[model samples]
Target: MTAPQRARSAQPALDRVDRRILDHLADHGRSSIADLAEAVSISASSAQRRLRRLESEEVVRGYRAVLDPIAVDRGLVVHLAVTLVDHTTNTVGRFERHVLDLAGLVSCHHVTGDVDYLMRVDVADVEALDVLLRRTLARLPGVARLTTMVATSAVVDRVTQV
Candidate 1:
């Protein structure tokens, strides 16, 4: 996973201590407050306060445990470029709602140019992928066309740095 990225434009500027705290947490979300304080050369209470502020400001959204897809029988990763038959607001809304909870979907991005949405799907194998595409994805509302590609390798997967 990449490091936690710097706060967005609307957020207040992060000082050196805040950056250190974020950097440490990005690498080790499971670390205790004492550990974080020690790493950032601050007190435990200070670390807690800073973390609270970050969370309240929506800077630190949440923490998650990263899992290995292969270990979980979801090794196959496919990218789909989907084009919608129409761009009506209602159609797009329905389409978005439909894909939001798909079982194997990892990410969905509303994109510009040739495609309406780009999706990352993970499954056990090509056979499973075929079933998903043929039975479900291809039949999704507003879907007019789709181009699929399987990923052979991943070169980088990191959290953005502070």
Candidate 2:
């Protein structure tokens, strides 16, 4: 974990006020303590106290600016469904370790079902995708097969809403 990231405590029961604070912060990440207090109908000091508690408890991880993929030259998004040769701990560990070296990796999930892992990758175009598939993904340890799906469009996600 990074310096500001703490290991989360056992799921803390959230009250209505906490939920409201989180819901407000989800859409307005840059809200100041005063703004957050006003939005949540709490005192600034209470907002500060609660926000600090949330951060220390790891419920509020950290703030980051969400960037547009096209603005960053990564206009194409591809889903890679990866099937490993086996489910041995060693095989899974090695495969996951290798995936960390891959560039343009937006997210990776080790999931159940036919595929062992699903990775979301962003690239400039098909040629870049081809390079990633042939040069990087194929060479990952214990990778038995890969299925690719190119996304035509992205749907908006409301991730942190209560």
Candidate 3:
């Protein structure tokens, strides 16, 4: 209905302390308040207050345990590059709605260049991936072409750092 209200600038004004807190939290999401305080060289109360502020500001967002793909029966990782038929808002919106609801989806980016979207998904195996491609991804709204690449192994798979 309406465009998102973006911040005044691209980057948030994070001081050294805030940076340290974020960096520490990025690596250790389940760390206690005392642990975080010690890591960032701040008092427990200060660390807590800052963490609360970060949460309220929607910077830290939420936390969850990172699961191993093989352990979870989702070891097959695939990247799907999508080329849309056109760049109409209606088409893109429809596509996004469908994509976000897809099972096994890790992430999706509305990217630039030759393709309209670049999406990463994890499935049980090749059969599951085939179904996702043929029955799901290929049938999305305004889809023109689909290019897929299955990851053999991850050389540098890690969570994003602050």
User: Model 1, poorest ten-residue lDDT window?
Assistant: 1-10
Model 3, residue 156: distance off in Å is 3.0
| Residue 99 shift from truth in candidate 3, angstroms | 1.0
lDDT of 1 by residue, 85-137 (tens): 99999889989999998878888999999899999988889998999899999
Q: Measured by C-alpha RMSD in angstroms, how accurate is candidate 1?
A: 5.7
The parts of candidate 2 lying over 4 Å away from their true place are 1-9, 158-162
> How far does residue 147 in candidate 1 sit from its true spot (Å)?
1.5
Which 10-residue window of candidate 3 scores lowest in summed lDDT? 1-10
Tens digit of per-residue lDDT, candidate 3, span 1-162: 234345545335788999999999888899999999999999999999999988888789999778877778688989989999999999999999999999988899999899989999989899999899889988998999999999988886663221
- Candidate 3: what lDDT? 0.88
Q: Which one wins by TM-score: 1 or 3?
A: 3
Residue-by-residue lDDT tens digits, candidate 2, 112-156: 999999998889899999899899899899999999999886575
User: Judged by TM-score, which candidate is best?
Assistant: 3
Ranking by lDDT: 3, 2, 1
CA-RMSD of model 3: 3.1
